[model samples]
Target: MLEPLGVDATCELVYREMLTHPGEGVAALAQRLGLSREDVGIALDQLSSLALVRQSYEPSGRQRPVSPEVAMRILLERQSAELEAHQHRLALSRAAATQLIAEASEAMADPQQVGVELLVGIDRIREWLSQLATEIQGEVLTFAPDGAQTQDNMDASRPLNLGLLQRGVRLRTIYLESIRSDAPTLDHVRSLIRSGAEVRTAPLLPTRMIIADRRLAMLPVDDHDSGRGAVVFSESPTVQALHALFESVWERARVVGGAPPSSKDADLAPQDAAALKLLAEGHTVESIAKRLGVSPRTARRITTSLQDRLGARGRFEAGVKAVRRGWLPMRD
Candidate 1:
């Protein structure tokens, strides 16, 4: 067993070596441990580093010696209570999955039926999503309001989404604007798009959601934690209505490159707008002066106008406000 003390293999060999060669040379200890001389030398070196082994040299030999018990103690140290906490966590997860499976989430009567299933933990929620992805014969709607970018998120979703897409299930996903900069997340998402899941995004969103076949829905119980939160899957009318609301929002979102607006335009402006457009392109005063064919004084005046109009203190803030005000197009 893996232990805080370490593992069984290293412990037993070291124990036997200590007993057989309490004060023998390192080479003799290596033979007893069935390891290479270098390996035994290193292990003993480590023991001495910990002060469990003391070094001494015979007439012509140099090596440290150790007691058998010290080697065994190092090899067989007990794992901490922290590991027991992990075991407890595993038990809790299994219990949650089992509870819903036994109850069948109101789907046993009709495994393919339109119904509501209440899942109380994150694992159960992801488990249901995976199952629906496997069973869905038609469409899957996904609205990931929270940025799920962890190992558990991938573990619960990657295969499920891929399998559904591969089988020709129509998949739709909506992302928040903030998700664009996460390189790993985008790579995974791009792969899904290539696999046939249509993707879209918007500026701000709330809660994570998935609706399977327009009949069963799953959404977060809370946003702070993926695991501590709850999931609701229901064929219940109230649940379905809420799902439709999400769908309505999803439909209104722009698909990837559905319509990328024009970049900062010279035509869209007052001097402030024109100035911000120039600033976004990395223009300095001299550059803006040259571009607009204006004097340095005139360029600085334009910059001041832009910042004040946007209620900003600097050129960068003005550029930000310009984008927010639709003076520049947004891309993810």
Candidate 2:
């Protein structure tokens, strides 16, 4: 019955037994439930991890079940928060799907057009990207959103990126501001910087993109699924517009590991401030953690700290106070 809340049958049974027969040892409960001692022990461990049980303060080292009134409430709240995050993610997926459908429809309507080409599937996307990389002559501008890049992605792009740098081709990439705290990703960025690539970070970015030599641009077909495919644009107006967007973001983004951010960045640490903005924007803590590339615990800590600093009772209030104090620019 409690499975929906992630309480397994054994754990729930053990919990119930402990509640009705307070202070009973594992062996006794194991005998009563006709389960192996190991099974009962494992259930206790799971319960402990869930905070449904704790070590007894008495001389005995047996586990103590927390009152359901308190423990269950916390579990329910956590489940509710996760549900909300799922809904928010679904909404984002729907919007991305709509955009993809429109772009695909347009491309289909003009089969002979040279403006847009839809490359459908990972293999096709990689082949096209490789072709673009080979043809690129002047510079490559990119937005690497969706948190810290995976090691596999970094490894795959290394040869291509190194080749560009070797040819003295300018390569500038913007990543999410949260990646600064990720050790491996940060090290990778530093290496790229040393190899003559320009790298910066912003608190938020609209989507993942790559523009080659101001002649061609690539955008993800689905923001959440990189392997799905991408849409390439070569039309002068479309490429030019994408270029303008990159330039605008580049002007505002902070140089990775360079000078301290400008005063306009406000009082909070850049990452924490970014987290606060996300919270205010109605993003769930789980989503915030993913965007920031930090653990949920760290995200929660940042949120709590921001709330304290702003003297706000909750995340929403903290965002309002931050804008009021000029910590964050008021959004339109």
Query: Cα lDDT of all candidates, in order?
Result: 0.61, 0.83
Instruction: Locate the minimum summed-lDDT window of 10 residues in model 1.
Output: 75-84
RMSD to true structure for each model, in Å: 24.7, 16.9
Q: What TM-score goes with each of the models? A: 0.45, 0.66
lDDT of 1 by residue, 50-162 (tens): 44456556664444445656644443222223233434565688679767755653343343554444566756766666666668899888777654355667656788888
| 153-183 per-residue lDDT for model 2 (tens digits) | 8998888998999999999999988888788
What is the overall TM-score of model 1 with all chains considered together?
Answer: 0.45
Q: Pick the candidate with the highest TM-score.
A: 2
Q: Report clash pairs, candidate 1.
A: 5-77, 115-234, 115-235, 116-233, 116-234, 116-235, 117-233
Which portions of model 2 show Cα errors greater than 4 Å? Answer: 1-113, 263-266, 330-332
Candidate 2 structure lDDT: 0.83
- Residue 298 error for model 1, in Å? 32
In candidate 1, which residue ranges exceed 4 Å CA deviation?
1-116, 262-309, 312-332
